[model samples]
Target: MSEPILSARAVRKTYQSGDRRIEVLSGVDLAVERSETVSIRGESGSGKSTLLNLLAGLDKPDAGEVIWGGGLGLDVRSTFLGMVFQSFYLIPELNALQNVLVARRIVGGIGSAERARAKDLLARVGLAERSHHLPSQLSGGERQRVAVARALMNQPQLVLADEPTGNLDERTGDSVIELLLGLCADTGTALVLVTHNAAHAAKTSRQLFLHNGVLQSAPKPIQP
Candidate 1:
């Protein structure tokens, strides 16, 4: 098989809380191939978010390395990495289209073509009708959808999402998950989704469980 789009080798993370040291991750290793979806499931405070941050290079791991194929190790920033958090980090003042356009401009450079691509992404996320709506005017699910579109605007090789469905209702969450999976498949983008919902994780190609700062593959394959 081709080299993994993203790889983490013996990754470890720790934080200093007051006078105490807290270990968030312990020698975790992971690999994501192109166009594959990998779900990381864990209870709260099990380091799921920390792992995502490390993978995306938002935070440096205390130990181990994150290697991005076709690029050097994680450094200033990774152009091939995109991330979405539980909180919809959309610019409240910007409309849905503008939010996605900004991301496109950041990675792909500003151009009429990039703006058009941004519009296409919003449409793909089923937010064409709400493109002009601000985050405040959109529902929670709508806002998350806008975030998803923004994350995809760069056509990243790897997408990291943390609790993507944490804020939506069951039905809305399911729809959002479906949209995420479908878009990633269509675009051939690898995804690493961090979620607590077993049902949500079950949608991915592979599922991993995080416990006590360690990660292990799920016993059973995740059925669609």
Candidate 2:
């Protein structure tokens, strides 16, 4: 078998609340293989987002280690991974196309090729006509679509999405989830999604529930 794209080795995290130190994650382990889609579901405040932050290297674990298979070092970290969040973190001044191109900032200077790639990604996210529109001009769903395009702009091997659909309506959320899964599958990108929606979670190749700061297998839902 091939090595995983990401692995969390007995991760542990804690936070101080007044005089008490609350343990958020206690020795959690996870591994995501290439081109695989994995969804994590848990109760609110179950440390789902915290686990993602740890996985993305945005936050350090109190114990254990996160190993990225690519081993690209800190300099190329942006190239090795992509990320999506509950809030659409687009630049208000930039258009949808420009927002996507921002992901290439670490790569090199933007050129015609980069611009073209950004356009293509915007189109893939169903926002081709709105490519020139600013985030302020877009609807909630449209904004999130732009965020999705931006996440894939780097052609990252893995994407860590935390509540990507949280702000959208049910129908819109469902569509976003579908698009995210399709794009990852088409690009052969590994995905670790943290969501609260059961139906959305079931769409992934694997599902796990985070309980008591540990991950447990979930019964595979029937595929449509």
Candidate 3:
């Protein structure tokens, strides 16, 4: 098999809320290979986002480690990772083009060519015409599309998306899903998506259920 772009072994996490310890993950393990699409599905409060945070190095596990490109998260550097969230977390001040460019600017700042690349990314997401619009000016789906383009701005090896379509209508959400999967496949970027929508999860190459703080294979085909 191809080497895994991201992997977690024996990951454990817990939280203490006023002396009440809540265990979220217990020895959870995951592996995502290059250009592969993996979906994580679970009921609410199952800690799916927590696992993603650990994988992205946004949070650390009390035990175990997350390895990316054969190195720890910090060792891998932020440029290797891209993130999209349920909410379109676009900067209100920046326009669509600038929003995408901001991602590149964060890593090493942008040059003329980088600006051109950002435009291309927006075009790919079908937002080239809306490139000058602000978040308030765009519709829900358009904003999400902008977020998707920004996630790809860094050309990251792994893209971690948390409910990318959660806020959109069914038709718009389907379009976003197709665009996200197609872009990942084209760019060879590994994708790990966390969503409650089984029909959406079914489209991925592999589906895993997060239950009781552990990861397991989905029981059967997910009916739409």
Candidate 4:
């Protein structure tokens, strides 16, 4: 089989608060296969976000390392990975289409083809009509859809989403999750979703729980 798209090897992380060292992660090991979807569920303050940041290379672990397949490295991160956050981090000034295009700012090659792709992604996320609206003009769900389009802007091999539906109502949140999964499936992109909602987590191909600063697989497959 091909090498895993991403791997976390014996990773550890800690945070210091007034001389108190908090162990956020402890010797965690994980491997994500290409095109596979994995969800991590945990209680509040369980360091799920910390683990995602480490895997994304946005933060370094206190020990061990995160390895990327296909010779991927931080310098070319935008070309290989995408990230989504609970807070729709769209530039308030840029419209939906422009916000989606923002992901390409670093890895420039923008032209007609790229613009078309951005439009296509927005459409995929069910935001084609809202492409011209700014974040302020869109509702919570629409804004999140724009963010989702932005995340897929680069066509990365992997996407790490941290509580993408945290701000929406249950019904809207469910739809966003479905849209995300559908888009990822169509693109053959691997996904690592960090969330607290058990129902949402169950949608992924695999489920895991974070506890005691370690990653643990679910007792049985949670996919349905």
Candidate 5:
């Protein structure tokens, strides 16, 4: 088998609430292969987001490590990782086109070709006509589509999405989900999705339940 694009080894995390210590993740491990999709579902406060953060290098594991592309020293923000959150993190001041360009800028290779790619991504997400509009001018689903475009701007090998559909209504959420899955498939980007939606989780290649600060295989979801 090909090497996994990302892996976590015996990861653990903890937090302090007032005077009490809370263990959020305990010896968690996971691997994501190229173009593979994995979904994690858990109750609120089950450390789902924390795990994603650790995997993305947004946070450090208290006891273990996360490795990307077979190493531990990679910069998550560079070309290796992309993140989408429940709240659209688009800049209010930047238009959709410019917002997508931000990722390319982050990796420090801005030019006409990259600009063209950004515009193409906007069109892929059905935002070509809205590319000049600000986040406030777009609908919630439109904004999230822009977020998806931004996430792909750097051609990341892995995309870590945290409740990407949490804020939208069911119909809109389904569309966003379809768009997300379709893009990831087309780009061969490994996806690590953290969501509470069982139906969404079921669509992935693997479904995991996070409980007691650990991850376990979830039952196979019934197919229609």
Candidate 6:
């Protein structure tokens, strides 16, 4: 079998609050293969977001390691792991294409080829016509699409998304989810998504549940 694209082994995270220590995750283990989508389901305060942060290297774990295949290692924040958030964290001043271009620039110097690639990615996300529109001028779904395009600017090996559809209507959320999965499928990028919606969990190849700072496989065929 092919090696996992990303793997987290016995990961743990803890934070201190007023002289009290809170454990957000404990001994969590997960593996995601290339071209596969993995859903993480949990209630509020269940540490799903914390786990995602660790996997993406936005935050460090208290213990354990995250290994990346393809010689990427655990330095995801500095590596080619892309991330999208529910808040549509786009730059309000920059247009859609510019937002994506900015991400490419940060990964390295953006050349003409990189700019063209960003434009193409925006088009792929169905934002070609709105390339010049700023986040304030776009709808919620459009802004999220721009964020998705921006995440792909580096052609990342892994995409980490936190509640990516939580801010949209059902129809819009479904469309956005489809777009994300489609793009990841086409690019062979591994996806680790966090959501509370059971229906959304069913879309992924595997589903894991987070509870009380622990992670386990979700029940098969998560009920909608």
- C-alpha lDDT values of all predictions: 0.86, 0.91, 0.91, 0.91, 0.92, 0.88
lDDT of 1 at 215: 89
Which numbered prediction scores highest in lDDT against the true structure?
5
lDDT of 1 by residue, 1-224 (tens): 88888888999999999999999899999988999999999889999999998888888899998888745665424358777879989998899999888776555568888878888988898888889999999999998889888888888888899999999999999998999889999999999999888888999999999988888987674567
Q: Per-residue error at 36 for model 2, in Å?
A: 0.4
Cα lDDT of model 5 by residue, 79-114, tens digit = 888889999999999999999998888779689999
lDDT of 2 by residue, 107-131 (tens): 7789998889999988899999999
- Please give each candidate's TM-score: 0.93, 0.96, 0.96, 0.96, 0.96, 0.94
Model 4 regions lying over 4 Å from their true place: 220-224
Question: How many steric overlaps does candidate 6 have?
Answer: 0
At residue 4, give the lDDT of candidate 2.
87
Q: What would the per-residue lDDT of candidate 4 be over residues 53-172, giving only the tens digit for each residue?
A: 999999999999999875577987887898989998989989998898889977896799889999999888888888899899999999888888888889899999999999999999
Candidate 6's error at 136, in angstroms?
0.5
Instruction: Please provide, for model 6 over 81-144, each residue's C-alpha lDDT reduced to its tens digit, 9 standing for 90 to 100.
Output: 8899999899888889899998877767978999899889999999999999989999999999
Worst 10 residues of 5 by lDDT: 70-79
Would you give me the overall lDDT of model 2? 0.91
Model 6: residues with Cα > 4 Å off, grouped in runs: 70-79, 221-224
Each prediction's total of clashing residue pairs, residues at least 3 apart in sequence or on different chains, is 0, 0, 0, 0, 0, 0
